[model samples]
Target chain A: MSEVKDTQGQLWEVFIQTKKGLPFKHFGSVHAYDKEMAIQNARDLYTRRGEGRGMWVVPADAIVAIDSSDDESFFDPSNDKVYRHPTFYELPDGLKNM
Target chain B: MDNLNLSKFCIRLGDHCLIMAHRQSELCSNGPFLEEDIAQINLGLDLLGQAEALLIYAAKLEGGTRTADDLAFRRPERQFHNFMLTEQPNTDFAFVIVRQYIMSLYLLKTYQALSKVEDDTLSGIALKALKELTYHERHFAMWLKRLGDGTEESHERTQTAINELWMFVGELYEEDEIDFMAQKASYAPTGIEMKTFLMEHITAKFSEATLETPHSIYMTTGSKKGIHTEYLGYLLTEMQYLQRAYPDAKW
Candidate 1:
């Protein structure tokens, strides 16, 4: 299908931090006219269920992503680096979260 | 403090919330876009939850057999004590935002006072609802600014809405017998105090939005006696249809 024209302002991606010490995870996107509106729309859409303690909204166009054509070159090289898994290391007994 | 008067007071507040919730619900699927649609519905749900809490407390205080559902769905137009402004029709998006901005500010101040009252139940409910109303006030205030200052057409529509709704605001601060009694019992702030605070805040916000407050001298009044605009009855017909058709029907 052809790309549909959008008149609903700008697109914003929402990230939500479920707890104070945790990092914000990508939740979803919403359409808004400005930064304040983007934040409010993210709040109304994603945080209605007490889902987050903090939120961040970024313009959708600001994100940079690799194209699908580059997936093989970008990801295949990492698979052969088995020593990077840190399996040869030994940990002390009291280390809990390592 | 008279239990009868206190119960009536709770019913008045609950009716305001219930009717406002119904009005917001009317815009559920009709918002300008999907995000706005969800936002409006979320607002309605917040009001609905508040209405349930207040009405349940009112029923308990009255020692009545009627449940919150009965209070919401079974009351006739004349029995509802909501302010006339709450029942006003959503003539347009500008009207809806303007109405919400006014009512949210009114409720924010009222609830702030109630949160400090001597009554535990009412004060507790007010404390919790206060948090929600804070966001409601901010959201609408933002919209009011955008619409008021956006474009020529939007500015005109927003100004017209303010001019039309200005008259109904007087009813919010008119001290009736119930309000007088509540004030005597320290259950609420005095009408003059609330009016002063509301008008000052409204003036400041309107100035920020580049909107002028109408100085119309003919302020309408009468919601204290269960009187409302003609729009309320039709709204009730639609809201109460299922319950009226099948008495005691449950989802």
Candidate 2:
């Protein structure tokens, strides 16, 4: 058994997919003793109303996240690149598939 | 099929769920861990839902002024047909999980059989219940393995629980005269057949848990006839307190 690290067992980040082929969006987090319990607890906490068709749970500690302090360094450079967006070009009114 | 027997059968199943769900629900704020507390509460709610559905079906088949509420609340101690095992006290978490494991195994077999039957309502309910029971069975089964093999105290506590609760397993297979009639009319499954699956699965799991198979020949009987341990009356007192105190109370 994993040592009881804290009152709320291991923190697991939960992601839920509403239907098949849908991307698993971050739903919330749950506390559980281990991987299976994490999935079960995630199911109970996140899927009570049948809101999910698929679920993924990862340990919160396993994630690698950029600090908020790095926001300027990571994403600020892309802000001025309006040409990278589809709206930069105007499409013909009759171009249905475009 | 005879309406009396069929309703009685439904009530029997309902009573088991109701009584056991009550036990599980009592742990709402008492679980060893927060996650476990929530998980068990969810399980209790699932059983409560299953009980209500079955009880409503029972009331419907009985075809009288008696509603599901009346059947569930107004009934006296002797009228309930839940197993003695279910009404047994939650001595500890190990016993609780052991009790759930036993009942879940029986319920899995029972509902699986029920899901295959012809009655639309019963089959539909069983099918729905099977989905929930899958997770419930897994939850307790994992607990059994965890507790049975974890620390020395956990292993000992759970091992004793298995032995203590093993006697109650016989009552689950104890068929009544009405049960025979129901089975003959294709209204119910042969419980003995269900026990075969339960025993096989239980033995394998128990062995994996490093627990000895209970070889004790002592078998506690007499729950289907509304006979139960001292636990049932006390359970009823708490369960029926609201209804008894305030008749027809509703949200």
- What is the per-candidate TM-score for chain B? 0.98, 0.97
What DockQ do you compute for every candidate structure? Answer: 0.93, 0.59
lDDT of 1 at B110: 79
Question: Can you write out model 1's per-residue Cα lDDT over A1-98, one digit (the tens) per residue?
Answer: 45998889999999999999788899999999999999999999999899999999999999999999999999888767889688888998997646
RMSD of each: 1.8, 3.0
lDDT by residue (tens digit), candidate 1, B127-163: 9999999999989999999998899999999999999
Q: On a 0 to 100 scale, what is the lDDT of residue B230 in model 2? A: 90
TM-score of chain A of each: 0.83, 0.80
**Poorest stretch of ten by lDDT in candidate 2 chain B:** B185-194
> Cα RMSD (Å) between model 1 and the true structure?
1.8
* Residue B115 lDDT (model 1): 95
Query: B15-130 in candidate 2: lDDT tens per residue?
Result: 98999899998898898877788889999999999999999999999997688889888999989989899988889999999999989988888788788878899999899999
